[model samples]
Target: MKLIVTCLFSVIMVYSTIAQNVAISDDGTYTADNSAMLDVKSTSKGLLIPRLNSFEKDNIPLPAHGLLIYQTDGEEGFYYNNGTPSAPEWITFTDESNALWRKDPNKNVTYLSGNSDSIGIGTDSPSARLSTDGMIEAMSDGYKFPDGSVQATAVFPANFSGYESAADRRWVIAMCADEIPGSWEYQGFEECSKVIDLEWGIYVPYEPGGGGVTGNRVHKPITVIKNIDKATVRYIQELVEGQGINEIEFHFFWINPDTQQKQVYYVITIGDVKVIDFNHDVTHVGNEIFSHVDIISFAYEIIHWNWLPDGIEFQDNAIGP
Candidate 1:
């Protein structure tokens, strides 16, 4: 039975109004400094603050601001109430990351990294930065993807990042009899009747090479073109002279959808890197044929329509912008 009189939880105290000083001690010595209203000292034992397990700690009724305790539950450590009576919050100290992570009495991951400066979610080895193995959500603000983008204005969320843009582009439709790469024929070609029965119409990027250096070199060339029939592709992407609008690039990753091979590509969406080129070949079944059709059709369309005015030019070059 511990007996304390003056203060509810005090151990021992001595006062000398004549000396104009007060002192409290557990080892029978007045070691408190003269300028203190309260001083506690123990030589053989340590002072105990409010200590409770996770559940017990959470049940504090109307805990005042700054209420602190040492929790002995799931995320065992010291915790503090972030000031709320209805739904008091308990912030925990994690030893693994050696930081204080915010905890809502009922939730696990309140904040990423548990307060660590560098945080990685899916992977244990987080970059000396930040990484999430999933999509991030923002209310309605603009965004900056991992690849790269060309914005119509100086804002973000990329007004145009190879997703959709019709400001300065032409349209063409081509179709092929089968999935065979050699059977693709543009809807409109000159000098002869169409031999390939490839009927495909989709806006393809003919505009590339405007933004300055992207550190991506012109990959190895693919050159094999026959009159109206293209077996290969090459050449200069249109270079916008001034303003921020420059080149547009389409990155291709060969993948076969018929066979469920590696799911790496499907797990994530692409749109924010720094370069574009022929990289990665994932086989499922008929991906190569479809890719061939796209390459040939768009290649010729770009050839016939690139750099031409928005509409047809009449005699004497009288036209509209």
Candidate 2:
């Protein structure tokens, strides 16, 4: 109480006597600068500001606008209230408007320091040098495994650039086609019987003209043959244009409901030649070919709609040497 009274008395006396800018200094030669309201000059010592935690800082009664304070807890930094005394908004001095990488207060796990430190993503207590509890996606520069094995984002053979294999083609086809739930047979062509048996392939009826018989009602299969054909043709074009050798051996068959006979279609590229051999002998139609590209085309447009490119047999049977 005595100390407070003495300090208040001293301030009153100093205000009464000094009409000019106030200067607090130990040296006799030091004088107050014209621009400054109060300047405290020190050589060895430093001026100590009021330090408070986030809770204590908030509790400060009627905090004036532009009130400077040093926050000692949470994201520790010098803070200044930019808002009015009625509604104060404390802003950190370190937060730059133009900074690319800024501290996010909402995220509690990110830890940064001056020294060599471990970075933890989605985790506070990191175990390794760089630990992450979530999936680490590598976009451009591919990441490495714990065993030091590198996994690139895109992997392609040196000779076959942008050349997707039969498996990739099948995957694309499967992805584009309508998915049959559970087993492959639910209202689709998977339950259909194979019409013909080749050395390395089996021709399955994708669309048997109309729907197949199931119990009382006839379940119609989703006609994805056209989509499958377009995808297959596009894949073939890509393979041929990329100068990659095609090793695809697949059959698409259309069954006639009248005679129970099947019209077969063979699609495979040996070197650069895209072969779509249509078995017209079953229909007694002559073998007529169309200009597929400048290189290859098909004449039997009716059979093109019946193609169902599925379960491709990846055989080493190349037509040319």
Candidate 3:
């Protein structure tokens, strides 16, 4: 009885030690590591995990989030659990030369596809090089805003050349440069008092070397682009055939719908030289008044030369006596 009771005590101690950790050895010895619950040590063969066919894998019982297994039949590869404990799903992490690649279940609704030339968004089969089902945005507003209404002011620069001389003037006619002849209200005409924005300037014409070495003064006329833009200015001369100044071809006036005002476009092509205009304005005005040149004289009379010849110049300064 003492021997039997001693044997039972030894068996109990052995089981208690095995409960903490269990290790299997090829030499038929059970060894355990201090940190791990179970460890297998072998030199001949490796441990084979449970292999499953597609049908058998689908029939798994309750699966946890971190469950792992190896598929044996179709798409033979390793799979991991990407689902919860209740609703578990096995997903292939990676596929080498002998594996398969599947789509993400989360991105099933919106797919992404691309090619060498172009990429497609929200589509699988793209017809064009780069096709997209979403709206696109641009970075420039130069062509977007044809009227230069946003992100830029339409006001033009002051004619510095016009101030060079009282007799010698550089006047830009606005009514001649209209794409379609018409006038609209200022964008914010209500903000101004009864007065409107005036884009007016002065221009006079007289014959050079008329009476003597100086010249002769002719009746200078002031032309403006009012409502209909039919006004005319005539400066008749005796030396040459006097023609109607209103008949001179220029661009007509135009109005911008955004500002609801007449856009002040300058005279670009006056016979030959096309003037590049950088000025625009939207000043409110009720009417443009036209008046005659009051102080007319033969002394230093201004010549009405629209454009100079190729070699000749307008303001050629050469230090004369």
Candidate 4:
């Protein structure tokens, strides 16, 4: 019995030494001896068992897997599942290649390309071209009349003929013009009294060339009466007494029938009266004496000329010799 107990204690010591000798290699594979206990100093390799007393099935192939790792000086090292043997820095699936790629558990994939210093994903191709010359030409090519020109002419109404006559219904003719200051002269009429028996006369307001140059001129005629009676004179006086009469002075331009030079006719009417101021005393006049005097009515007429041409050019000032 003493010899059997000593043999059991020696077996227990050997088993304890084998269990503590188990080790793993640098390639992540484990190795051990076939004994139920692992061997520490045994140089020979064999099937790896994960732990002491763990079960092992013989002749079964070991499962194999791979990992890709990257190393840079300043960046942390990481691993990818799809890296190829040729370009371990880039990873690819069956369809596309990616560098520094990752996919989350939700299946979203991201990748980086270009210099490792900068990175981009989901970007492709480049941008489309504008004309600077056409704009400059349009701005360069973009209408450029004199002073004191006139546009239209002046006209008078069509129905105007002349003023009504005072004597025998015959129309009186007259014309008006601006007189030069010293050039206006009057002949064959009393001062302020324009009545005259002559065929023609002139009224010039200045001493022949004083006031200014004439702008417009018109022609008109006067009505005349041959014989009148005293009763008619009295009746005419009754018609015109106390009524205001217009004092019209005339400047007439008459063409000589032979010489053809223009001669001016002037006349003035002071008080075109219906009543005669007889010098004879009204109380002393016998009925027979009053029978001889006669009354006459007279008026001036205006004649218009249409011969003046439109757009006539004239000197700014009248020419004087």
Between 1 and 2, whose lDDT is larger?
A: 2
Model 4 spans > 4 angstroms off? 1-204, 209-226, 238-321
State which candidate has the highest lDDT.
2
TM-score of 3: 0.27
Our model 3 lands, by Cα RMSD against the true structure, at 19.9
List TM-score per model, in order: 0.28, 0.32, 0.27, 0.15
lDDT of 3 by residue, 183-296 (tens): 322343211111111232333344466743433323222232232211111111211232212222332233332332443333222221122121222243521221211111
For model 4, residues 155-194, the per-residue Cα lDDT tens digits are 1122222222222222222322221011112232112111
Query: Lowest summed-lDDT stretch of 10 residues in model 1?
Result: 262-271
lDDT scores of the candidates, listed in order: 0.36, 0.42, 0.39, 0.29
lDDT digits (tens) for residues 1-321 of candidate 1: 345444644435444232445555565556556776556665666657777988798788988777889987688778888768777877765443454455455765565444446667676776546655543445774454463222111111223222122333212212221111322232122111111122223232344677554442221212211213231222112112112112212211111222212111111111111122222223325432122222222211111112122443222111111
* lDDT against true structure, model 2: 0.42
Best by TM-score: 2
> What does candidate 2's lDDT look like per residue over 215-291, in tens digits?
33221211111111223444344435543322222234333322223344333322232333322122323311111
